[model samples]
Target: MTRIALATASADLEARFRAATGGAFLPLPPAPLPSNPAHLFAQLDGAPAPDVVVLDAELAVDHALDLATLLDEQCPQIAVVLVAEHGPDLGLAAMRAGVRDILHPQAEIAEIQSVLDRAALAAQALAHTVAPASSDAPPATGRVISVLSPKGGVGKTTVATNLAVGLARTAPNSTVLVDLDAQFGDVATALDLAPEFTLADVVHGSAARDSMVLKTFLTLHETGLHVICGPPSPAAADTITSEDVSQLLQMLSLEFRYVVVDTAPGLSEHTLAALDRTTDHVLLTSMDVPGVRGLRKELDTLAELGMLTPARHVVVNFADKRGGLSVADVEATIGTKVDLRLPVSPATRVATNKGVPLLQSGGRDPVTKQLRRLVERLTIPETVTAQPDPDSRPPRHGRRRGR
Candidate 1:
């Protein structure tokens, strides 16, 4: 029987998880809570290492971080998953403290189980990779890309959706697009695929850690792109914290070669958590004055917070010559070079409105070609491509901003 341990402070939550896990649930050992969390190491010194530790973030953020750090130092093999009520920012903090996965207080049993299963697999994989005989082999590290924007209505979702499809089309490896915007996500509608299971379904199920619930929840697009759509109801968003997002990303990274995350606008907890887990952050903005100004402010904030990394790239979406601001002027104002510029195409809006991806129409359109080139530049390192000049002239802006 699998030995699972629940370290949550809530009796109701413990009972629910116990009922769901049945006989596999292991009774948590009696351990006194330390008034000073710095003594946590001493308190758990002789205690048997849990296969999985489900910590409650409500107890204390600092305590949670301390516990995660202690667990990593004392029992590096043990997998830690945190449960919190806040958004992904907390999850990112927990991750920084050494937690492998995170979940919200209201996370479904199935979702918890999926996280547990993935954690177990990751632990086992680590053990095997570290074995004396296999020590010479290099470990596998997957790529995690985050799609972000400072302000809303900048076509971040469209860019994310098309970029994901474009990557899947260009690369032979498996790709998964996760809608992290739990409140107002439209990834499913954009792809025109109605999935039988949403992320909510996976979170609510009672399947074990090794169950197929997670794999089954993903909806495969016509372009062979797999997506995990956000919850249907906005009210459900409150239940999804930063920790949950972190856990989901960690699990997805194991199975996918490329994971494209569509984040909500602004620097919410969820957005921060996504950024923390991401290997690359794609900053999306338009040619509008307010958009450029907002992007600059957001980038500055990220830098101030020490969150900006070398992998962060600025992507200019809906680039048109007729736009009021030229590309150079936009870049000069923003104080950042535009890494990739996606041309405005009328078919993009039509495709989105009709519930289809632009890539599905064909790979021949100028916009599609640019999108494909963007993906190529991202994936291939040896191939040197010319970077667009920040001072370069912008295409003429048309009557409507073609997304």
Candidate 2:
């Protein structure tokens, strides 16, 4: 549960916060907003630190901004959200102070809940980065695969569809594919699924409340993979945010063994967010000048932004010796070996138009064989001999003395 410390002086707003969180946050004493600016930080420091600190910007915008800055320096772990009327000065100051968001003080209850949920997810992500997982413990979290491309018409959806089908065969019902091309996604058409629920449904639904709730929102494919298609229309896509994707992935990670994301062509806000959370990056490019050049720039950007920590495998799709660019040339241009070269197969177009994955319908042809190899790569068993298990963590010295 996310613990939110509500520092607003308005009794009505405080009541709203309590109702909106719906017992998600830990109980705390009535918040004290010290009138004296000097004591504000000290007052907050004295209280039990919460996962989030929601400040009332109406009280003292300057003092709130300064206090947010101080909290960021002194208590960096705790997220801060300033609730104020939208204003240029306040928004700028809050951003400079590293506040999570500058929201309206009188926003609807649902809005406040969404903000709190997002803050909780951010806090959890921060913790995961800082805390080391026990080597003895098997990976209980799902593996994330992000299919990315710089320009349109390079077949990102095709790669994502085949990869998800391949993974589903390996992991069965423990797989999900998200069509994150919010405005324009064809995952449903690619697989011939007329999903009743798209990503918008999942976001609007209380799927975040429980992973099981999320399952109901998924469209089960004959391939044994569940899917969350993109918005049916572009306008609805605007309602979805990067924060929504972050929270959705976190929840999905708990339930599914693998989450394959089909991102829109080119980098968008949500695509970058998906990249931030991905464990594997299947960077797909065609054997062409623009595609090669775009992959280089994409690599440079991912490197600069620190998104390369995830294992990145560059796949040269539609590769052919006679193509304008050779495999060697493409590899030299990207500064990375071509991990997998996927040839353009006639079977691909036929299967896509038929709404079945090539991996499902191609029947062990060269393309399906290659797709199977990719799944085989992901299913390699971990070497347990190198790591200690939880049972071996404690010493048994006292028993030895008695013996």
Provide the lDDT at 88 for model 2. 57
- lDDT of every model, 2 decimals: 0.70, 0.75
- Model 2 is weakest, by summed lDDT over 10 consecutive residues, at 383-392
Clashes of each: 16, 0
- Any residue pairs clashing in model 2, and if so which? none
* Per-residue lDDT of model 1, residues 1-403, tens digit only: 3445565557777766876676465544444333222233223323333467667776676777787786665456667777777665776677778788877788787887787787777667655654446466765546778889988888888878988988788654478898888889898888887765566554433311221235544677878888888788877788777777777777777667789999999988888777767777788898788888999888776665556555657888888879877889877887877877878878788988998777766758777777776677668864323343333332221111123
Per-prediction CA RMSD (Å)? 15.8, 18.0
Which numbered prediction scores highest in lDDT against the true structure? 2
> What's the TM-score of every candidate structure?
0.61, 0.61
Residues 1-403 of candidate 2 have per-residue lDDT tens digits of 6667767677777777878987555332345454332233333333334668788878678877877886665456668888888875766778899798877878889998888888888777765754557688755789888889998788889889988988898889999999999999999999999987789877654464545345656888998999999989989888988888888987888778999999988879888778767877788898999999999888777665556643556778888888777888997888777777788888878988898888877586777777776666566644101221222222221112113
